[model samples]
Target: MTDNKRFLLRRRPEGAPVETDFELVSDAIPAPPAGGFVLHNHFASLDPAQRGWMDDAPSYMPPIALDDPVRATTVGQVHASDHPDYAPGDWVMGLNAIEEYSVVVPDGFTAKVDVSAVDSPSRFLSAFGAVGLTAYFGLLEVAKPQPGETVLVSGAAGAVGSVVGQIAKIHGCRTVGIAGGPDKCARLVERYGYDAAVDYRGKSAEQLADAIREVTPDGANIVFENVGGTVFDAELMNLAKHARIVLCGLISEYNSETKHGARNLWQVLAQEATLHGYLISAYVDRFAEGGAQMAKWIASGEVVMDEDIQHGIDNAYPAFMRLFSGANTGKLILALD
Candidate 1:
């Protein structure tokens, strides 16, 4: 295809992102120059982190410039290459713009994929990609979950959270997941092996706290926090002494103008809890080790991978919105083919 279709950042969103926040533009695909390759993107990984990247604020990565194709991690086939390391028709993964085609340097985050190791190209963007890596390092390295500990995960049915709960279970921790609806909660218990599941939908703070207390009678020793709003507040109320709180992502406040400041932070002091906020990039050097171990668990049937994929790049906008609305059960991916 000579024409590349891409979604460009139109404006910074005030609250939840709307379609108007981005503009879909079609342009001619560019050829690779020397030491570069042309990628025909087949899958775009939609993440909550993308929302933060859209804003014109100081963050770990620079914000996407207005009218530029939005930044995303993509899995694609190398269409053409001037780089000796990559050849046409090779499947690769890397940081790329949200377009049908991207020009990439052989170095940096771009790497050839081992198709034999994964079920499909989309799987690389899911469990085997940043999602699983985030869960693995966050739980094992940061939380330091101990066997027989009570582990609670918020946003338990999401890409990262689902994996977090399962990894906690593998460590012999009693896992409790807090998801939005009853069905997702059921999936946490039935499919992901969480010992208990709490549905936070339509429930008051008191009710949510009661539900958490019921599952974690001795209090939570480790809390894998993904959604940071009332759900986090509820978890804070039930923290055990020296509780380890892995502050992964705050999806609840990503789009809002006013963030939900946790009123119960004092509990962290009283309970002698350790609250840690981390970026996945911090563990970059050890990603290979983490990915290898996750692959072993998946291969042995000890860990299950779940994905909610939306076909076509045309659906990328609405599909991305699903993450905030809790419409996706696991990893949310946009398949271009």
Candidate 2:
């Protein structure tokens, strides 16, 4: 039997999670049961949504229970299998626990990964994975942006936000990005094809609104909102008539005890704007359709993919914290091998 190391949830966090909230335990890796497969996980995804999964609250998915391995999306090679569809050497991606090894049934969010289609296995967790799919469906299906419209994206340097900005550009819309720090702001304009960028590092909501207005004189016709709190307020103040807001994530409020409700929601009523909150899982039936389009754009040089990767499972907690602190500029990944 192989010894497997896993991080188990030990306590529910009050605000931001600390490393002490999890307990690392080692045990023999379990063999696959009938029709199940064993995966030797190599990379695990670090996402802002993981914070919500830690809380014992009603959500789209069940909360992670104490003493259970921390839930995560992982890419790995199959080490053993009793399933007909899976083999020992196949590469796969699935929603598995954060551990060196996992035994899972080939159901739910599990699928074989075609490594030949992308640059690396990690891309399955980033641009080519949930991040890309979220951007695709959120912008095209939800927002339905058109040419000459102004598209505003918060957390624009992040995985999903960056992709949202680029996809908006592909649709011939004027793209504006809101991110922390000058470096990330510059990256949004220079690298991600954003027409303008607002640095929200030390700016007030009014300041952010003014900056956004300077770039988009007609106001933003479509808002791809990721970071909430003041960022949402800033964007709220700059919405065009009948603007569409595609709500993807609320990273800023994820770790806060008292979440900041959008103060300018009345703007939605005043401007006749539409706000739509979505879960990527809802579009699972059409994932292949979205993935194909994103892959085409990636190959044609229309979309640029970026990832921030850290090595070792021991650094998982710190790496996860980087998402909240804005230390990571793109999709944050933890490479176990």
For model 1, the superposed segments whose C-alpha errors exceed 4 Å read none
lDDT of each: 0.89, 0.91
Reference-based TM-score, model 1: 0.98
Per-residue lDDT of model 1, residues 1-337, tens digit only? 6699998899988888889988888898888988899999999999999999988888899988888888999999999899888899999999998899998986567778888777888878887888999999999999998899999999998889889988988889999999988899889999999999999998877789998999888999999999988899999999999999999999999988988878689999999999998889888788789888988998998888898989877887998999988999888988886
Note the residue pairs that clash in candidate 1. none
Candidate 2 C-alpha lDDT tens digits along 140-175: 999998999999999999999999999998899999
- TM-scores for all candidates: the values are 0.98, 0.98
Residue range with the least summed lDDT across 10 consecutive positions in model 1: 106-115
- Candidate 2 C-alpha error for residue 92, in Å: 0.8
lDDT of 2 at 272: 98
Total backbone collisions for each predicted model: 0, 0
Off by over 4 Å in 2: none
